[model samples]
Target: MAHYERDLTGNVDDLVAHLDRAIPQGSISAKYEAGSDHRVGDARMLVRAYERYSALGGNRVSLCISVLAVGEEMSLSMVSAGGSEAVFFKVNTFGEEAFLERAIQALESYPG
Candidate 1:
């Protein structure tokens, strides 16, 4: 598994839209699987799950993203798992990292 987290300053809706577009850009098999959006008090929360076929590992990898926002401040968390190449053990993590990179790349230019 691979994980990433970041603290950002931006509108939750904007960031979510940006991710929704960029996360699935490179591969045809990449897709958003599920999501939840909630607002409690002043905070808005979004949780999303995505999956993609990993050729390097010959399996499907899953990526999950969570965002919590209060006004203009936001916190983002991402995790990637599965797609290990080993049959008996979780050895290869390249697929997870690679799939996670799509989100990283998406955030590169975000002014958050």
Candidate 2:
């Protein structure tokens, strides 16, 4: 099984390393708009990346972490041979945090 992991820590090197490790030989044609290097500025960018990647015939998974003055949030999603799934959790960031946590958990626990 291939493993892909990404953290929204704004760490470009870490993101690149994870992509390199996760993608199989010749599986990934390229890396488009990784969250590292500030290439991913918003949720729209992320969604677009995933859509494009999926079109390329590869599994795509993403974990996004967002920090705000009020609190923090985490989001997770998967797109692959099994299909596509996404969830959001919202917790300390008011109600948004709970959504983020739940989304991540659901996507992670999904049988697919």
Candidate 3:
């Protein structure tokens, strides 16, 4: 799990658009949901991947990312399958900071 607080503001649509650019197209499938909670904007994403495991003959990957925004503050969390689960196995192969950096970049570049 990861957490971030930022002094930025934007609509959920704009935020989701920025996130869309951050995610890679190699994802086999992706789902996104955006809404507001107590005046705070929120977005959730689920992504499934099989491309990385095609060569290794390994299990696929399932990733979930959630973002919450209120005023000039934002919090983000990302988790991947890593334990005994239903559809995919979890693997903590990368640092959350990497994803956070990409999100920050996206937020900065979004004109809205």
User: RMSD, each candidate, Å?
Assistant: 1.4, 13.1, 6.8
Report the C-alpha lDDT of model 2 over 1-112, residue by residue, as the tens digit.
1122333334333333343333322224323334432233432223313111334223343333322211122232332221233234311222222223333443344332
Q: Comparing 1 and 2 by lDDT, which wins?
A: 1
lDDT of 1 by residue, 13-103 (tens): 8888888888888578999899999988988889999999998888999999999999989899999999787778898888899988888
lDDT of each: 0.89, 0.30, 0.43
Enumerate clash totals for all models, in the order shown. Answer: 0, 16, 2
Model 1 accuracy (lDDT, Cα): 0.89
Ranking by lDDT: 1, 3, 2
- Model 3 regions lying over 4 Å from their true place: 1-11, 26-57, 82-112
lDDT of 3 by residue, 27-79 (tens): 33322333233432344332222112222223433345455655444555545
